[model samples]
Target: MFGEDSPEFSLRIFGDIGMHGDSKSDHSKANFSFGSLDFVISGSMGERLTFFSESLIEGEHADAIFFDQERAWVAWNEGDSFYLQLGMDNSVISRWNRLYNHGRWLETTITRPFLATFEDQGGVLPMHFQGLEIGGLLAPAAGDLEWVAIIANGRGADIEDRQRVHDDNTSKSFSTSLTFTPSSMEALTFGAAALTDIIPADLNSAVRNGSISEQIYDAYFTWLGEQLEWIGEYAWVIHHDGVSGSNFSHRLIYLQMAMPLDDWTPYTRFDLKVMDQNDPYFVPVDQDLDQWQQLLGVRHELTASSAIKLEIGFGHGQDRDAGGAVSSDDFISAALQISWTF
Candidate 1:
């Protein structure tokens, strides 16, 4: 730990690395690649305050790496159940979002679900929201509940990557989520979340001028028992582009289960996402994205903070209006990755 003269402040550094290989088709040769490198800093301020930040050196254009911010937040705790935070936040809208990230060592898989991607990664929804969040817990004998409310600049995609910057819209977005954990089944939890925002198609324009109104709905579940853990999530989105006077809808959902055996854990997952074939958002990207994916994998715990994994997955995509040489065929891939934190 690194600290100043005061004992109230301290910091720790950790790193994450990943590598993989893939083949788009059975007859095609596999392509290998370096996944990512991330450095994370987390520390404390006295007893009520703390901060965390992730600085990433991620792969970009072939053999290139660019620096990016995954999360940087300072928080103050009013008590165990109440806290406030301001900064670039991740997974603010969904439970699954909060649970997974670039840290492959922190999760069971190297690849994420289609809906988990950000706007730049071809995701229609916003995963990063620069904003303020107030969250707390409610205690009851029968069950305990957790809730989080968010107010942020929302998300903007027309420009580069500035979703974590200031707002370009006249109005801000509001989101909230609630989770319930029952006493009878302490290992199980269920949650729901919603967000309403207006994303500018032309970020250079004003909010009401040429923006799209978007509303997202989500439901999620988590269960961890003595020998098994399971997760399931579903999200639906509605986009109304008043500028074009057109509406489009999209859906994403997934279910996964993992069980530990001695020092090894095996897992399975299924994911599916669908979008309107004629979505206005597709005009810029050049293709509508829709797919179904399935995965099976196993992880061996080399130590408390390190692991190696082997996974195999398959999927197919359809883009009726696809241009160029885009194929709407099925693909299969396998990967071997190792990750650690220190």
Candidate 2:
């Protein structure tokens, strides 16, 4: 990220597009596509405040595209100790969601772990919330308390396997995260997160109360070295009445490592996501504790502003509608992507 010193209006135009194919059982699949076109407009109001609006038009299929206002927010700095933001922006719920946005070139892997994509992209969790975030820093250097508190319209109603629009219920959600940097080792930080929201109850059954709540707990560790970076996170979701038939509980975890060697960097990650067999949230598709994938990739920087990445993933999982036996979409996949920005 960069800015002009003039404190006046500034605009930047950038985009990422790529194409790839996968060979499975001697058959090739072509998924040539465009990633995103972004327009960022930013400026400042004198000294203590600044604002930016980022608009994105993204590729969804071979011949289809969609436009979304992913970020349109303002930041007000209350000295070096506190900050406030409002409007449509990143929820900052996790390390990955905070470190990356629509910019694919900033990511080490061509595809995000299945768990981190935005809600519409089949992600199991909501990566965005419309509301406010207040955060602060107690100490400047590592080894202090850095925290965020979120109060937002949790998520919209689940319709056709997707969460859309505003909150389906009148109630909002409250969440928080706290990270402690050990004074002894500034490069390492450990964090804990907790959140709660309401989801529609199963139509087939009813809880003693009308509201069904979902609770989430997460923990993460990070280490940043001279040429290497390591990050690991784990989260669990529990609901008292997720499905019409029963309650739900699910867990997900991922560990990522990257080493930059000059213009060439090699990276790898392990991803796993699963739900208890009786997880009601996955009732639409009978869920099981059997979905996992591992990925390995390498990225080559073509220039200061361009990069090419290649990766392969292999995994297996099954989801059956209603209640059925295991039938799956299991395979090994490969992809090559090119990303650039300016």
Assess each prediction's global lDDT (C-alpha) against the native: 0.75, 0.73
The residue pairs found clashing in candidate 2 are 143-181
The residue-by-residue lDDT of candidate 1 on 1-342, one tens digit each, is 545423353333334444454455333355455666777777776677788888877675456777888889999998869999988777556676787656668777766777676555666567777889999999889899999999988767462445676677777888999999999999999999999988766744443357778899999999988699898889988888777688888888989899989889999999898776555555466335678889999999899888888888888876444353444768677877777776
What is the C-alpha local distance difference test score of candidate 1?
Answer: 0.75
RMSD of each: 3.6, 4.3
Q: TM-score of each candidate?
A: 0.89, 0.85
Off by over 4 Å in 1: 1-19, 25-29, 203-209, 319-327
Candidate 2 lDDT over 26-97, as tens digits, reads 333767677888888888876667788888898874467888777777888887679898766665556677
Worst 10 residues of 2 by lDDT: 156-165
Q: Count the backbone clashes (under 3 Å) in each candidate.
A: 0, 1
Runs with alpha carbons beyond 4 Å of true place in candidate 2: 1-7, 22-28, 140-142, 159-165, 201-211, 242-245, 277-289, 321-325
